[model samples]
Target: MRWPFRIAMSTTAVMLFDQAVFAGQFLAGTFGALHTHRANATYSGIAVLVAAAAAVPLRWPGRGPLWPVLACLGLFGLIALQIVLGFQRLLTVHVPLGVAIIGLAAGLAVWSWRPDRVAA
Candidate 1:
């Protein structure tokens, strides 16, 4: 697998795991909206970082780690949307959007698994 895609997968997994842990506390209302906002900020920051770091690697002379980078970027956008939805208390949009992102990320990971698609 490409190193960049591996990184993407690992990062995504970490993000999910972190969110899961955060959810427990979030449900408990450990810090109220502060925890919620912090989680959103963290996700947005990660997406920006992932997109920047993967840009060159996914578009250079190599075949490109196209799917991983795109997936991360897409997720980043969705995360931003989620924050807005959360702020508006739009539970319907927020939940579905989050699911969509995870689904897309999984699809990207599968697509990136192809031998010729991922950067080395």
Candidate 2:
């Protein structure tokens, strides 16, 4: 659980950092530079999400096992779809979904590492 939490936390942090960078790239009007960071954050986010999903069944301190796993899967699916929407240049969907991901990932990471959750 700790390991998974750490991975999830790291990915969220990556997203947070990249978002700022993305904004900078946008402001600078260098769309090309954004891709590398975008790719890095997305790919790494997916990988860490997988790791956290795998950990869900191992020893999740939470009362229900499936909820955590499902949550991870749900977020994973959303992010996977988000990538597709991005490549297709669907800002209508992509930008909002990215915001969702940032919030969800950050929320989960904070929740996971909370002292109370770990104590349980």
Candidate 3:
């Protein structure tokens, strides 16, 4: 159980970070949006580090709570949607999905450290 969950969580976190990094590269080299893209990459990097921290104990016998895992799942889903929308240019500026992603990532990271954390 721990192994499976840890693998899933780690994979998702890496995916999240990878997606953001790709977006940054695209923005900087192709789209000429270096500053904004760099910021995005930074956020994604932070998310990765936080997620990694959470995953640390998950590899052990007694690990994280449910909310953190849920948060990661939710955040990953939303980010996947956002990534798809990016390809379609369907993401609107007024929409704050990016901010939401960051918030969820931060939330999940913090929640993962909670003593009573459980899997759902």
lDDT tens per residue, model 1, 1-120? 266755565566456545545655767777674576466557644754564465456556555545555556667777777778867889788667766665665555555556673335
**Winner of 1 and 2 under TM-score:** 2
lDDT of 3 by residue, 2-116 (tens): 4443444554445444545556676567564545554554455455545545555554545434454456545656755665666566748313676566555545544433455
TM-score of structure candidate 1: 0.66
TM-score of each: 0.66, 0.72, 0.47
**Candidate 1 lDDT:** 0.60
Worst 10 residues of 3 by lDDT: 109-118
lDDT of each: 0.60, 0.66, 0.52
Q: For candidate 2, lDDT tens digit of each residue in 2-116?
A: 6655665566556655765774787699887677756765775566576566557445554434555666677778777877886788989877887887777777676666563
Clashes of each: 0, 0, 4
Q: After best superposition, candidate 2 residue 100: deviation in angstroms?
A: 0.5
Candidate 2's C-alpha runs over 4 A off are: 16-20, 57-65, 117-120
Stronger candidate by lDDT (1 vs 2): 2
